[model samples]
Target: MQRYFIDSNVPESQKISIGIPHYHHIINVMRHVSGDQLIFVFNAGETYIVTIEEVEKETISCHLTERLEKTVELPIDVTLACGLPKGDKLDLIVQKTTELGIFSIQPFEAERSIVKWDEKKETKKRQRLQKIAQEAAEQSHRVHVPEILPLLTSKKLLLELAQYTHVFIADEEEAKINEQKVFKKLLNTMKINDKLLIITGPEGGLSRNEVTSYIEKGAISGSLGPRILRTETAPLYAMAAISYEFEL
Candidate 1:
């Protein structure tokens, strides 16, 4: 069934209303009309089987037939703290990671990052990414939409590290990351609701000085693989591995 996320308070009545853009999608692209069925999710575990009942100028009304509980969300909260990458690659990162059940994403300024969002534009950038996260969450059937937070400097990120229990940075240079030790240890030890912070560097990669700083913060090194991965791909790989490590 075609899926869309709606506000949590969507009533349990036979009829439900959708906003203008969604109406356009139903009327135009989807060609949905009366009697067509769709899926509506709160994206935090409440799903309704909806049947199109009425199509109006700016809204499409649907009828709720049944509801189901969602079981797809990750057991733990995973935060991706990525060093701002250049160009449009971050768009892919935000969209795909939201689908993978990441709890939140943070963009931090690394020493070698080529693209910099200054004090003024950082907030706007984050808001845009958050919108993308919401859309991805709806499309991917995620239980809860992931967050895209305001920018942080690497130093600022390190300072806030104590809030999370499992903190690891992906270092292509690290030998320990390749071994099963860090992941195995995480699987054996961490609790379900434990917060996992994953930090990935930028296109220029983390400088030696920056690597030293992260290492000092008790961030154990984890390697992705043998090939040279792009800034965006590395985080996705790391997140998938983390999901496999704990939830599998």
Candidate 2:
């Protein structure tokens, strides 16, 4: 069944109305008709099996058939704070990481970052990335879509580190040191419901001073194994490792 995220309230009568893009997707794109079943994820993060009862010119009416109890979210909330990379690397990172169970994404300006997003560009890019996250979440059958946070500078990101239960930074320098398993060790210390922030630098990677500043703010610097990963690849690796550790 096709899945969609809905923002409106699901009334006690169990009857729901959908409009615009979703209506178009159901009627034109997917060619769904009355009696076809689809999954609806509500704002409260509840998933319901809904049956289309009426297909109008602009609206699709659906009735809740069953509420699903299944959850695919990571036990721990993992937020990715990535330094703005060049090109569309952030798009790839958001889509893949959402599938791999990332909770939220934060794009920051790093000391070595080459790409710059002005105010107007930042708003447009955030809107685009948010749509990507929603689509990815639906495709992955996720009950909750990952949030695309506003852009922040490295200094601003440091100030917000206190909100998370734990913070980890992917440092290339750590990869060169043999027998460093800080990532694994940190994972071992994690528990259910913990909120973790994983930070990765852009193409040029984070500077030494930036890493030191992060460490000062209580973030543990770790390597994503011995190999140096690209800006986009690092977060995916971390998400996969987290899924393996906590889900598998």
lDDT by residue (tens digit), candidate 1, 1-248: 23577866667565778986577776898687888777677646576667888888888878887665444776568899999899988889999888778999989999888899987788778878988999999998887988887788988988877888878877776634345366545544655457888888998778778778877877766667667788989888876876676445
TM-scores for every predicted model: 0.68, 0.72
Cα lDDT of all candidates, in order?
0.77, 0.88
Candidate 2 stretches greater than 4 Å from native: 1-70
Model 1 clash pairs are 43-143, 44-143, 177-222, 177-223
TM-score of 1: 0.68
- Name the best candidate (by lDDT): 2
Clashing pairs in 2: none
lDDT of 2 by residue, 176-241 (tens): 565368988888777546899999999978999999999999999878987767889999999999
**Model 2 lDDT at residue 190:** 70
